[model samples]
Target: MDTKRFISFEGLDYSGKTTQIKRLKEYLEGEGFKVYTIREPGGTKISEKIRRILLDKAHVNMTGRCEIFLYSAARVQLVEEQIIPLLKKGYFILADRYVDSTTAYQGYGRGVDLEMVRLINEAATYGIMPGTTFYLKFLPEQVNKRTKLSGRELDRLEAAGLDFYQRVFQGYEKIAENNKNRFVVIDANQGIEQIHQKIVEVVKKRTLEEL
Candidate 1:
């Protein structure tokens, strides 16, 4: 696989990953690159269904183990059905979440075993890993402020509370530390345009390096 073409964005909800992704997609398109953006736990018919189940607040009883399996199931389907094919066709794939989310949210926040999470992630992705992952760094409190400002209802995961989010935040820090070669930590507190500029610069540099 041409992993260099596969980039992913990771962050807590309300961290501006969606905005950055949109900006990057437009920038890539302007540069004559075909960009394909897809959100995790989604991007296919079966995955979309899994996404709904995973995010539905009504499923509050869902266990962490079940959550892990469902997310992996969605991811495997997406990898085989959409991501792999698009990468083969020379598209720049921008993913809005990936295996890292499970490592942070499920393994750390939900108290699942990290080794188990690692195995599940590897299986789900078919050993496919992104060449670059932009992690938007934000504290749980900052996210809460953003959420309140937006006045949006919380989904199952988003409503996981401050303590849970704190664990996830720390988990992300550890993951980024261990994967420094592939992880780019962006301060989510920056101005939107500043963040976008940084992302564009990094992508441009990586593109050149890969070539």
Candidate 2:
């Protein structure tokens, strides 16, 4: 399937991806475009069930391999049940996270083998990929600080310590470097409006170019 209308946002928790996605969706709709926003591990009914299991703080002992497989399972379901169909209808699909999240969080954070992670991600995505991925870049320390200030309860993965998050951050850096043509690195530390403006600018340019 053509993915020119598929845009994804990636970042650690508290990196403001959800907010940015909401803004982008609103902006797209205001421009008279059909927009669909979905979150990874929990878009379709089946996927949402897997998402609950994956994020439950009670599942602390889940193995890295198991975690990756579960994530891939959810992803494949969302792709087959939701993403592909939305794209076919000419809707601009915005994903909160995608395959790269698995590479960063499961492969790097959990110390899973990179080669194995690559294969699983390829299988789950069925060769479908986002046309543009906006990575909200922020240091692990900054994310931790925001989490503490927010006083929100941490999920299983979010509760992973600073070292784990650091590895994930580094993984994202490597992935972005390797896929420069598809990744757009954005400074997430900026004011919300500032970041939104930058994303809108890039989205506008990309959509126009694709057209």
Q: How many pairs of residues collide in each model?
A: 0, 0
For candidate 2, the C-alpha RMSD (Å) to the true structure equals 0.8
For candidate 1, the lDDT comes to 0.94
Candidate 2: tens digits of C-alpha lDDT, residues 158-204: 87889999999999999999899999999999999999999999988
Candidate 1, residues 40-97: lDDT per residue as tens digits? 8899999999999999989999999999999999999999998999999999999999
* Model 1 poorest ten-residue lDDT run: 202-211
lDDT of each: 0.94, 0.94
Model 2 segments more than 4 A misplaced: none
Worst 10 residues of 2 by lDDT: 202-211
Each model's TM-score?
0.98, 0.98
Q: List the residue pairs that clash in candidate 2.
A: none
